[model samples]
Target: MRVSIDSATCQGHGRCYDLAPDLFGEDEEGYAVLTELTADRDVPEGREGDARLAAANCPELAVLVHEQVRA
Candidate 1:
C-alpha cells in the first residue's frame, strides 16, 4: 500500500502523526507530513494498519491510503 496527503485540505490537526509516527510526521508548522518513506509512498511492511488508521482518524480526511495492485 501507499499513502499520501492532500495539502489543500490538511488543517494541521496532527492526528496522522500522533496515531502513526512510523508512517507520518509533523511539519514545522505542525501539519501532518509523511515520514521518511520513499517517493513511491510505499507503506512499509507491518505498517499498513498504521497508515489506514492515520487516514481514518484524519479529521480533515486529508490523509490517503492507496492500495497497490499487483500484476
Candidate 2:
C-alpha cells in the first residue's frame, strides 16, 4: 500500500499521527508528514487497517491510501 497526504487540505488535527504513529507524523508546524508510504517495512500486525481508518477519519480528507498491484 501507498500513502499520500495533501498538505493543502490538512488542518493539523493530528488524528493520523494519533492513529498510526509509525506511519504518520506531525511537523513542528502541525502539518501531517508521511513517514512510511510502502508496506515492505516491518509494521506491527493489525495496524494496517488502523492506518486506513485514520485516513478515513480526516475531516479534510487529506490522507489517501493506495493499494499497489504487481504485474
Candidate 3:
C-alpha cells in the first residue's frame, strides 16, 4: 500500500500524525507529511492499518491510501 498527503487539502489537524506517527509526520506548521523512509512511501510491512486509520480520521480527507488493484 502507498499513502500520501495533499498539502493543499490538509488543514493541519494533526490526526494523521497523531494516529500514525510511524507512517505520517507533521511539518513545521503541523501539516501532514509523509515521513516513510522509502521511495514510494510504502505503508511499511504491517503498518497498513495505521495508515488507513489515519486517512479515515483525517477531517480534511488529506491522507490518501492507495492499495494495489488485484489482477
Candidate 4:
C-alpha cells in the first residue's frame, strides 16, 4: 500500500502524525507530511493499517491510502 496527502485540503490538524508517526510527520507550519522513509511513500510490509488509520483519522480527509488493485 501507499499513502499520500492532499496539501490543499490539509489544515495542519496533526492527526496523521499523531495517529501514525512512522507513516507521517508535520511540516514547519504543522501540515501533514509523508514521513515514510522511502520516496515512493510505500507503507512497510505490515503497516498498511497504520496508513489506513492515518487516512481515517484525518479531519480534512486529506490523507489518502492507495492499495494495489487486484487483477
Q: TM-score of each candidate?
A: 0.89, 0.76, 0.88, 0.89
| Candidate 1 per-residue lDDT over residues 6-42, each given as its tens digit | 9999999999888888678888999877777724688
Cα lDDT of model 2 overall?
0.76
TM-score of 3: 0.88
Candidate topping lDDT: 1
Q: lDDT of candidate 3?
A: 0.82
Cα RMSD to the true fold for all candidates: 1.3, 3.4, 1.7, 1.6
CA error at residue 7 for candidate 2, angstroms: 0.6
Q: Candidate 1: where are CA atoms >4 Å away? A: none
Q: Rank candidates, TM-score, best first.
A: 1, 4, 3, 2
- Scored by CA lDDT, what does every candidate get? 0.85, 0.76, 0.82, 0.84
What is the Cα-based lDDT of residue 32 in candidate 3? 76
> Between the candidate structures 1 and 4, which one is better when assessed by TM-score?
1
Q: How big is the positional error of residue 34 in model 2, measured in Å on the Cα after superposition?
A: 1.2
Question: How well does candidate 1 match the true structure in TM-score terms?
Answer: 0.89
Model 4, 1-71: lDDT tens digits are: 87789999999999988988877888899998876452487887788888888889889999988897647
Ten contiguous residues minimizing lDDT sum, candidate 2: 36-45
- Candidate 1: RMSD over Cα atoms? 1.3
lDDT of 3 by residue, 1-71 (tens): 88888888998999988877767888898887888542377877778788889989999999888986647
